[model samples]
Target: MAHRSFLPSARAANVIIALGAFALGWAIYVRYALLEQSSVGLACRTLETLTCETRATVIALFSQSAFGIAALIGAILQLIRPSLIMFTLALMATCAGLVVYNNNLAGLAGGLLLISFARPWRGARG
Candidate 1:
């Protein structure tokens, strides 16, 4: 039998890295554009424009830690049954949640995702 590698394939790793980077970039944009205490945020609060509306919607979504909850759930699922899709979801949500004022749960989820890296493949035998 061929030896099973501990880590994912290089292509998978590349996809994960690229997607994670994109997620982080998008999260950073959201944090600065719609959530920070800058002139943009001030305009979002004071004006009645499309950008402000979008900002309000984003704020509403994160108000009750929706992103954090999603990340936590996704991470839990990923830990139970590791897969690229679940990993990607958890990773993206963790990045967004952490940047969008949902650090508590997001941090926990990130820890779980890290732990999941040690989990064996679904069909791997001892």
Candidate 2:
């Protein structure tokens, strides 16, 4: 068997890459007004309620998508790269999922499962 450590360390690199990707995704949605209008003005009475609900909707959408993507990527990366990078990516995705998914329990569960299992990098003790 090949001896390679996927331990979650080296503190890694390419985080900015992932961040940039996320930023790009957000920007694209904003620029294009792509997020559906279902949540907007769902309740016009009381400015505070409308604002809160709008924000919540956006967050829910973002989180749900983030979680699904993370799970998918984590699975693929587990087979493709070092564990550290995969773990880092999985962690980021989990955060996004936890923040945005409406049914947060499901999102959090999926994201955590991915993070918990990413292989450890070399010398990545703990």
Candidate 3:
């Protein structure tokens, strides 16, 4: 039988790239436009508007390192059983976490994801 490589196909790579880029861009927008913007921050701290409420919610989640935690969990799962879904989840969460002040666990998750790439192909027979 012909050997099947574990590497992602071009289409899969494109999808991953697109999703990762979107996650990164969204995180940057939230960090700069919503969280760091003085007007937005002030409004969120004081006002009860819908935008401010949304900002507060995002702040609470990132403050608790939810994104990093999720990335780490996805990375660990991917390391244990390498799958495209888990890999994509970890990649997207890692990108978002790194940009949204969850760098510590997200960095660790990134390393774990890298290590997982070295794992033997799941379909390979010994």
Candidate 1 — number of clashing residue pairs?
Answer: 0
- Give, for candidate 2, the lowest lDDT window spanning 10 residues: 27-36
* Candidate 1, residue 42: how far the Cα is off, in Å: 3.9
Write one digit per residue (lDDT tens) for candidate 3, span 26-122.
9998889888889887766667888787788888999899999999999999888877778899999999999999999999999999988777556
Q: Which stretches of candidate 1 lie over 4 Å from their true place?
A: 1-6, 45-50, 123-126
TM-score ranking of the models: 3, 1, 2
TM-score of each: 0.83, 0.38, 0.87
Largest lDDT belongs to which candidate?
A: 3
Cα lDDT for residue 9, candidate 1: 70
Candidate 2 residue lDDT tens string, 35-116: 3445443543345664556565665655556555654566466545446545555555544444444235435445444544
Model 3 spans > 4 angstroms off: 1-6, 45-50, 123-126
TM-score leader? 3
- lDDT values for all models: 0.83, 0.49, 0.87
Residue-pair clash count for candidate 2: 10
RMSD of 1: 3.1
